[model samples]
Target: MANNSLLEIKRSLEPHVGAKVLLRANGGRRKTIERTGVLEETYPSVFIVKLDQEQHAFKRVSYSYADILTESVEVTVCNDEGQVRIEYLQQ
Candidate 1:
C-alpha cells in the first residue's frame, strides 16, 4: 500500500523536471527554510533541486517522496512567469 503511494508521487513529479519550484522544508528545532530552484532530477526514491545562487550556499538538495507524503516538505512548481502551479507537503 505504501509503495503504491510513493510510486504515485514519483509519477506526479516526473513531468516537471527542469521547471522552477519553490521549496519549503522543516529545518528542525521549529525552524523552516524556503528556497527557489530548478527541479534538477528525479529518481526512484529522491528528487533534486538546484538552488538559486543568490539565496543559498548549497548548490543542491534532495528530498524523498515520503517527505512529501508525510508533510515535512512542500514543493510548489511554477511556470516561467513564476505563478504557482501546485503545492503539496507545504510545511
Candidate 2:
C-alpha cells in the first residue's frame, strides 16, 4: 500500500490503539492481545500489542494492519492453568 493510504488507514485505526485486537496469522488460527492496548511503530508500521498477563503459551506480538484485514476477529485465550477457549467478535 501507498504511504498516503497507510496514513489514512492508520488514522482510522487510531481509536483502536487502546482497544483489544485479534491477530490472525498465515494459518487459520488466531491470537489475542489481552488487557493491553494498541501502539504504532515505525520500523514496519505495525501495531505494537502489549500483554496484560504473562501468556505461558505465547509471547507479546506486534500485528501489522495489513495482516489484519477485517474488523471481525477471533480471540483465543489459553494457559497452563486452564483450558483453551476461543471467541469471535467484532471490533
Worst 10 residues of 2 by lDDT: 82-91
Report the C-alpha lDDT of model 2 over 1-91, residue by residue, as the tens digit. 4555545555555544454443434443465433432233323366566554544343456655444444333233333455222321233
Residue 44 miss distance in model 2 (angstroms): 7.2
Report the lDDT of model 1 for residue 76: 86
Off by over 4 Å in 2: 28-44, 52-56, 69-91
Per-residue alpha-carbon lDDT of model 1 for 11-58, expressed as tens digits?
888889999999989999999999999999999999999999998999
Cα-based lDDT at residue 36, candidate 2? 34
After superposing all C-alphas onto the true structure, candidate 2 shows an RMSD in angstroms of 8.9
Model 1, TM vs. native? 0.87
Highest TM-score model number: 1
Q: Which parts of model 1 are misplaced by more than 4 Å?
A: 80-91
